[model samples]
Target chain A: MSTASTGKSLAFTAGDGYHDDPPLVAGNLSFHEVTDLVALHTEKKTPMAWYGAFSIANIGLMILLLSVAYLFWNGVGVWGLNNPVGWGYAIVNFVFWVGIGHAGTLISAILYLFRQKWRTAINRSAEAMTIFAVICALLFPTIHVGRVWAIYWSLPIPNQMEMWPQFKSPLLWDVFAVSVYFTVSLVFWYVGLVPDLATLRDRTPLTKKLRQKVLGFFALGWNGANRHWRNYEKAYLLLAALATPLVLSVHSVVSFDFAVSIIPGWHTTIFPPYFVAGAIFSGFGMVMTLMVIARKVYHMENIITINHLEKMNIIILLTGTMVGFAYITEFFIAWYSGSPYEQYAFINRATGPYAWAYWTMMSCNLLFPQFFWFKKLRRNVAFMFVVSIFVNIGMWFERFVIVVTSLHRDYLPSAWDYYTPTAIDVLTLIGSFGLFFTLFLIFLRFLPMVALAEVKMVMPQSDPHFYEGHGDGHGAAHDLSAGKPESDRGKS
Target chain B: MLKELTRETKATMGIYEPRRDKVYGLLAEFSDPGALLHAAEGVREAGYKHFDTHSPFPVHGMDRAMGLGNSKVGYITLVGGITGLAVATWLQWWTGGVDYPLDISGKPFFAWEPSIPIMFELTILFAALAAVAGMFALNGLPRPYNPLFYSENFSRVTDDAFFLHVAASDGRFDMEKTEQLLRDLGALYVEVIEDLGTEQGPAGDVRGEAVEKAQA
Candidate 1:
């Protein structure tokens, strides 16, 4: 895993090449002080800015609830969905939220496997975002099925439900895929939170009994016993291992919902990998948007260092380009397939009715992220935030272009009709953001925003010191435990 | 009167009970991970079986230093995964081929190609659930109270200090000798925890059950 490039260079890492900056965390922080620093946020009253953001998020939540109720009350017709354009804003928003959810798992699970120490500062918040985004994503498909009450029938539950869910259908597969993803992510997030919660509990000696009970309850009696830590670390690694594959499959199955179908733009073989990449792309964008604001508001300049932002931007740049590549590949396939409908479906996307959305997606997802190629811009917080916002908007449009554009003009020209989202559709989409933020805000308010213990682990002071020619001169010469676990042994 | 009644009810419900007994075990605190790790090695080498170390996080070599074996959570996940695959495949075959067969597309009633996504999802579902369930079952969690919580000095285990607790139940545990040993090993603070033998209280026997299960 050492960065050594032979021959022609195709390098991904920015840190591998450039940027000599301060340490990841700012200020001379001792290991003992991490608990106190993070606990300060929870112990103190909510900031005025927090209240402002909270109220805004509350309004959005209200909108989301009303929209869901209205959709159920009146039916799917409340939105602008119809025969030709059946998969409109609901599917679009679902995919968008799901894509946004990807960065959390990528940061927490994938980066943990890769031993990316920089991720420690932002991983907790991103993981929370992932959970919240998934929650929003789950809402779409459930309510999209007009008879929301009959949604249970879609699941592969047993004898009670008259109809068994069709195994072959990608839609039914989504039921299993999404639910499993949610459960696993929730468990992973909670388990990671346990040690931090215990720290909060221990530090809050001056807090009221209610606070004590709450923190203690969630801390799960974790005493940081080495035996417990051993098991906990193993469990964490196992969850991370499981989650990496699970997150990939969850999105791949989502892609299958379209890819398995006979629709022209939807039926491409590249959808699985393409969707996963784009999900990571969009996920990073959302993470960037949050981290930029959070690091500032929480005074985490040192912890979420500029280098961390630069590294993330590099990922955003990479994945955004890959998505651009997928777009080109799709066009090549459409032309190569020699089918008129397939050709027409893609060509229409570029020059057809929804051409504005298509171009917007191209500009936002592809062009905007390419700015990160310059180190100056990537490190520039304001510019990165703007680009991240653009990425979010672009990714949403990417899904919209895929779902609505492909479906609107199908095999029969007679059935072709323009699909426009009703007010409820617009409001609902906005409302999902509300739900995401509300949960995220609550998380930020109560929990340690950064993984304090994990962040501490990456600190230089945590490592064992070797005082040469001193007392116990070489602490265990030929230290067997020092190396990575060889076949899971402590020593010979 | 109302407030007093509420307080009385809360106290009786054990909500107001102390989080831990002050007398848990002998606590030895270390300033750094190295010191703590060295102390763990010393404790392990001295043939103390019932002792444990508490720290802010999992130190890299603590497991090996403590002579602990690798975790068995993987075995549970593997078994659960295989079960998921078998059950999902069988259920799919029964539903699509045998019980309620439908051939709308003229493909086989039971197609493995189409079943892959759902099957993969189920396998992961089972594996993930097992991993979490195994973790909880292994870690002995949801125990909100521990005797360590009672010690003022021990609370810093999640903060700055490194700690090793030698249980009185350990056959080799002699109070003065243990304290002297911990001090020699560079423990900044050493507190011999007295076992009052009170009711297990809110911490429950979850850890004990998990440890037993793991051993068995």
Candidate 2:
């Protein structure tokens, strides 16, 4: 009781006993220490491992570039496109990358609105991932159009050609939806980075004049004015609120690209919700994959502790379960509808030509995450990392099954053909990952990977009343036990 | 004078103003947020109108302590959202139904159900843009030449320390009295921030004085 009043205890003393929830940030770190932990990665000399990874990513980017060039030089004919299967790896990769983009916004926007303080540690990098993933996502659609030059036809801008894109079409909606998603997400990420940029600007040594100026320019000369913080906080809140619905809508619109069609497997009411859940599932998986590596490489084990990894695992389990439920519901509805074509589609997915892909998706997305049900497995970094990789593979196959399986064998048996991706298709898919990793690795090198200011705000020292009942014990007490868990005060 | 000139180079481009000898404010750096919060309350209680607190992060209860009400950024966001909705609707309706009508599946040229996605996306885009832009516009940021930056200790406001500044523009501001009041509030450091005049050499003396006071 005496220790509780001192405000030095890690867990608050509830009525019965100690309520010891795991701290969001491990280790008793000071504000400056947290800043140093994140900023060091950017400020210090680039690690050899970063360069190694960057080179590999760049090679992927090169492959992507060459593939796109070849695709343009020839046409969509370079890939394995037939009468029934016009949509191939391009659409699957588009949906797959777009799904990966969801977790960042989910972490930055939805979790923010919920006041899940733990999001502070991971949100910045996650948002960056979202931006890069969306970039990769947008790449497919842009290049997918055989005539990349006339892509502007998708827009509503009046031109010499008086015709407008079909406004009623879900494809048109996707163009607007994805582009707007990218723009708003960029703005949100930048806005959140401003304060942190200012910190970096101040810390920059005078010797690095150019670095300081660049950081200063983007920082917008932020002075940490409370007046500014008032408006800034409101703006952040508003953006988060807007992004929450937008995140859900973006994926739904993506699913519309398929679900709006009359294809038996694609035409289902469950697609939108299912797609959104699967996007979040895949996104968290990607975030977990990157985070596990980044935290280890950057020596940020304290800031991004096992607790954070476990929490992400919990989300993975929840979304993975939702995705599996959707799969069953879609199959059940197909049979329940008594539509022969629909029944055939579902049956073919499981026991037909593409059954291998379907089964692979079922196991990876549905069964692999089941390991997270155990506390020990969820906390095991290596195990979670492997499952995360599986999630990525499974989610990609899920899209592949939906797009190719449905289209390859449609309403007519004569249209049935085995769809195999050409080497170009494989190269382009691999290249998109290169582009994603390159952008991500660059972000790691230049920017504060963690939200320093927000992390500081969560530290106990940020509380205006932290020292009210205590004496000289405040400094050492806070330094040693930084994450005193907002207590039962309920503000966090 | 070198200090003042060096600080100016860091100011945001295209907005440098050279003013004659004038006091920017008295900046008091507190060791922790609690001290700054209490100090802000004290300053408010003493009826100062042109005072602001600065910290590495937004201290909870700071707005109320500083008497700032709910931010107006939300209103700006609302306006932006409505504008986006209206524009998206008009763009879709006029372009699809009236300007260049298409007969697809015999569906109506214009309908709310089909238009909802675009409308919703634009609403969010515009609202988010307004929120960020409105916040920057209200803060009068990107004006890098804040006189407070001239104080070396002020840099830490973006780091670990908390600070409060009572502007010289305040109606009740008295230099000595404000400095003494901040000290009474147990500020770790108090220094007079000056807007260096174009007539420079003597500014060096003022800079030295500020540094001495900060050290005290």
- Which lDDT values do the candidates have, in the order given? 0.80, 0.85
The iRMS of model 1 comes to 9.5
Superposed model 2: Cα runs more than 4 Å off: A1-18, A472-492, B1-20, B197-208, B214-216
Please give, for residues B1-216, the per-residue lDDT of candidate 1 as tens digits. 997666444322212222144334577766567777888899989998667778888887888888878888889989889888988899899888888888776978898998988788788878878887877776667666555665666667787777787776556767678878888887665765544333754332212211101100
What DockQ values do the models have? Answer: 0.33, 0.47
TM for candidate 2 is: 0.92
Chain B only: TM-score of model 2? 0.84
Residue lDDT tens for model 2, A175-283: 9999999999999999999999999988887677789778878998898989889989999999999999999999999999999999999999899999999999999
What CAPRI grade goes to candidate 2? acceptable
Give the lowest summed-lDDT range of ten residues in model 1 chain A. A1-10
How big is the positional error of residue A481 in model 2, measured in Å on the Cα after superposition?
8.3
Q: Name the regions of candidate 1 deviating beyond 4 angstroms.
A: A1-22, A159-161, A466-492, B1-24, B197-216
DockQ of 2: 0.47
Q: Model 1 chain B: which ten-residue window has the lowest total lDDT?
A: B207-216
